[model samples]
Target: MPQYSIKDHLYESQLFINRSIAAAIIVTLMLLLLGVRMVYLQVVSHEHYTTLSKDNRVKLQPLPPTRGLIYDRNGVILAQNLPAYSLEITPEKVESLEQTIEQLALILPISEEDRRRFKKLRRQRRPLRQYPDPSTPER
Candidate 1:
């Protein structure tokens, strides 16, 4: 004859319920910790991060210092900076070089010497290049 055994249903149900409660508690605690850390970063340290972001966005460029005048031992000015204006024309931009020069002459005091110099420079310069006219009147 074989021996018979009975299952304890009540004890098994209690054990399963205990394990489920422990797992739920652990998950809830982890979620709470994550929420607290997010709040600290978003509210507490907001200004510090905001300032860093603003500084990164805005750039600072240093301006070049003005050049000083040089003098000789006898107090005579050896070298000094003077402002001068000149017109530059790009060969590619103008449709008719002769017509454009004529029109510019009417508006500005473009003398015969200026015209001749401009023509010479234009011929010597590589195509689509701009050369400063040497005949520009000193201001």
Candidate 2:
């Protein structure tokens, strides 16, 4: 190992201190710039950013309530509720659903006409609806 004289040792220590001080100054400046930017975003432009966030979350959901029944003088259900069973699907959750539907058809009672009808109506945005049996006679 080579030994350094007193003057060389002093020069090395001064160089190390200068580099450390320069690094600390750069770090301090970066932190100050980051703080200023954060304040500008949170306070100066908060309303504009909040409105943009709201627009991204725009949504429309339909609510359909059940209708009241109609009855005659005799205690009879002129209009009654019909039990409806529905299978719901999400386009995002289902991938290659035709193959999945084929698998389901093998296990369930699904006709070609039924599949065709489902495919036609599935693209429409109408909410599912079920009506009471029309032939139900008044008592």
Cα lDDT listed for each candidate: 0.79, 0.67
Q: C-alpha displacement of 29 in model 2, angstroms? A: 0.3
Deviating ranges (above 4 Å) for candidate 1: 1-67, 72-78, 137-139
Which candidate has the top score in lDDT?
1
**TM-score for candidate 2:** 0.39
Q: Residue 25 lDDT in model 1?
A: 100
How well is each residue in 8-42 modelled by candidate 2, as lDDT tens digits?
A: 88889999999999999999999999999999999
Q: On residues 20-130, what C-alpha lDDT tens digit does candidate 1 reach at each position?
A: 999999999999999999999999999999999999966666554368689999999988877645667787877987787777777787778777777787787798797
- Estimate the overall C-alpha local distance difference test score of candidate 2: 0.67
